[model samples]
Target: MTASSPTKQQDTNHFDPSAPPPFKVADIRAAIPDHCWIKNPYRSLSYVLRDILVILSLTFIAVVFKTSLWLWPVYWVAQGTMFWAVFVLGHDCGHGSFSDNPNLNSIMGHILHSSILVPFHGWRISHRTHHQNHGHVENDESWVPLSEKTYTALDAPTKLLRFKVPLPLFAYPLYLWKRSPGKSGSHFNPYSDMFAPNERRYIVTSTLCWTLMVANLIYLSTVIGPTLLFKLYIVPYLIFVMWLDFVTYLHHHGHEQKLPWYRGKEWSYLRGGLTTVDRDYGIFNNINHDIGTHVIHHLFPQIPHYRLVEATNAAKPVLGKYYREPKKSGPIPLHLIDNLVRSIKQDHYVSDAGDIVYYQTDYRMVGKKVE
Candidate 1:
């Protein structure tokens, strides 16, 4: 899958809708030749090997590459991409989607996310909640929507937090507070706790896992020199985030699909999951556990990561028009900005009959009801 074409290319090429939905998710799954399961040992091994190499290179930089800033950019590219890959694997762990063993998933996910400074348990809780209640405004994890009235009612100080940082890098720090728990936010990040009490255990565990990981940083920085920490490790971590944010955010928020936000019989896991978007990452999809097969992932979180495409393809026919695994080769920003524009102004979620509706972005009637 070539990166999706840019909007301009989309406009010019005109997404020939008749082109069979560009490969049905169901069809893809049915066609997953048995060979797809050989379980390549290369991905996990290669990335870890790279992590080691990155550390060594960082140490060398501290010792010799100090004359100029030339190596910093290289470090940024190397460390960021590699560790981010590790984070994606961590994501697989949260669902027991990586390997069947829960212990292994916990160990790997904790190591990877902690290495990058994310609280693993905190993220796992939110993400799991996200899976269980996706698209439901009240219970969904971190992405629960905000109505305009609610948004407006937020006290001035609270509102300030939304616009507090203009730059993405700086804004990253604010996310630590976006969890569902507030007591943990005492460091004073209001948005820090995003989950309910039932979810706290996972958060605590992931947090501890990362705490142990920081020891690696301590030893590396103390022994290898601060220069290595900045150049070899941090640089790659940054690069990895660029891709991580690009992929995950766009999969859900950037897509055109909006949750119908149904209740009772109206709310089927299938429909809500389909609200998720699959993407064309080209080779990156392979590394991401074909998480690009997101619509299916949301519906069956326990499914192993490798079999996602199978479930996706199996379910496509039933999904029909609900099927939306769009591909764009152009810049990711264009799509991201367009969608964020749609989501940011959300003010409320209103229940109408059996469905939910969102009010935002120019008057709305039945838009992808925010949830």
Candidate 2:
């Protein structure tokens, strides 16, 4: 379809949250071939093994070349990207896309996610909230903007910290500790608002696993010098946080045009899901497990990551007006820095009253003179 075509334009250029979706969710699902939905346990396991082997090889190289702290920069980038891929696999497992067996899924999810310091069940439960309310302003789980009133209520230091570059990138660890403002929950705390009472045992188990991983890291730090441990573990872990923050924020926020956030009668599963943007990180696409193919994943989280690209391609015709083509990127996705900066500057808050809301810039908050 031409870029200007009405159907294509709706996907790329317009999202009217107050309006109902043009097509039924069933239509889009039907367009994706049945094979795209199949979960191949062996194939899923292969990806998990591949990422692990790559991580191990990178670690081995870093250790063998210990004297060359110069190589740490390269190690950080490679290992950090691989950690993101590991999280994606755990994410699939949480959705039961890794296999048919629930027990196996839970075991694999904990191993992959907790090893990276994420509480698996904790993240999974909250992420389930995100999936269920992808574009609802009041209820969306992550990266939803504050209302103007709330934005103004934040202290100057808090405002600066949130929009400042590099600072927001490090927010994942804190977010896992305490959720976004106006929400109260630690992914690590089962009693927090993110999870149900019945789910506390799973949350406790994942939190314990995360604690054990931290303890193991402390032991390794003592065995190896703290400096070396920081170089090996801490640096890569921070980079992983950057990847998580960058990817999650871009998926929901950095489009050239504002995506609508809905409320009340305006919201529906299909409508809310369409607000998610797909992104392209060029070569990192496969290494990151097709996570940038996000629109389809938001629509059908149970479809395995390996199959998202195929499913997205197959569903596009049916999703005609809902799928925005991702902005192209080079291997490093440096181009996204502009998108992020622009969004952070202009996309500050939405009006509390609108059923369909768009972000409004608060010039006073940013100390900018608006023309």
Candidate 3:
């Protein structure tokens, strides 16, 4: 059944997020101003340039204050955050939201992602899969919850690594080398089932770029001393991975309300896209290019990052209860840490048979006896 018309005020207490939205995706799209859809290449490139400059400045500051033990920790956090910001710009390029020119997108995507040792095309293609099948239990590419049977079968060590705090936050590198459990392809492998035969060349190019970056890092480590290199890059890279995993997992898995995952006929593009939740990152919101404005980004990824807030506001009436308002954040988003920890402890898996189902807690994981 469709939801009420866009003009009607939704009684949120009675609203069913799983219900098919009353308004069509087209209606929401129409509400967004035409200017919101414009992909300004110059604006996109300016962000890329801005992030690079910040990254360099942070590096310079760290080098100058190398002897300060206190500054090292601060440098790691800031540099890693800048790295994530750079990755977001590359993500825009992957979505074709950075520019209308395909060649420019490809060139810049490679430069940005390769610098961070990411397989650009491979990640872009897989992320496309995620956007296409976001809430589908089996088809979604990243952070899809395990089915009950699959969850039950997992070894204790695997479960611990997957759901435990700090450990799960470091999972992105492993996820790239070998995708999430039950999935088979390596993002670096050109011939993996994740990509079509024609896309092999793009994957190969990205993989090679990633390899070159790794070699460059290795060379730098040897020349500059491993300790210095670790301080300058490796530590920050790990922190960036944490930011990536933390943000991505929260977008789909953690909320005060249980969000539904779909299977079979219940899954549709609009419904799947709607399942994504936005987040407020406080001060990092703009610094990270508003990547936390995930709901609107998922719905209309073609919209540039700079306009997500405007587009989200325009479409809110059409979205109604289908849209979840994100929790507000202060100067520091310390509150999200609680949400992340609680969700990891609670959201373990979905049932195997349902067309739509919410996550169920494995009582044992939460220090309770299984019923």
- Please identify model 3 stretches exceeding 4 Å from their true place: 1-12, 369-371
Which candidate gets the maximum TM-score versus the true structure? 3
Q: State candidate 1's TM-score.
A: 0.68
Per-residue lDDT of model 3, residues 103-181, tens digit only: 9999999999999888999999999999999999999988988998999999999999998998999999999999998
Error of 2 at 77 (Å): 0.9
Candidate 2 residue-wise lDDT, 38-133, digit = tens = 899999999999999999999999999988868989999988888888998999999998988899899999999999999999999889999999
Greater-lDDT candidate between 1 and 2: 2
Indicate the residue-level lDDT of 91 in model 2.
Answer: 91
Q: How many residue pairs clash in each candidate?
A: 38, 0, 1
TM agreement with the true structure for every prediction: 0.68, 0.94, 0.95
- The lDDT values for all models are 0.55, 0.85, 0.89
State which candidate has the highest lDDT: 3
RMSD of 2: 3.9
In the order shown, the candidates' Cα RMSDs to the true structure are 7.9, 3.9, 3.7
Candidate 1: segments with Cα more than 4 A from true spot: 1-70, 155-173, 178-204, 224-228, 238-243, 254-259, 262-266, 330-354, 362-371
Give the per-residue lDDT of model 1 (tens digit) for 128-163.
767877756455554445554455556655544442
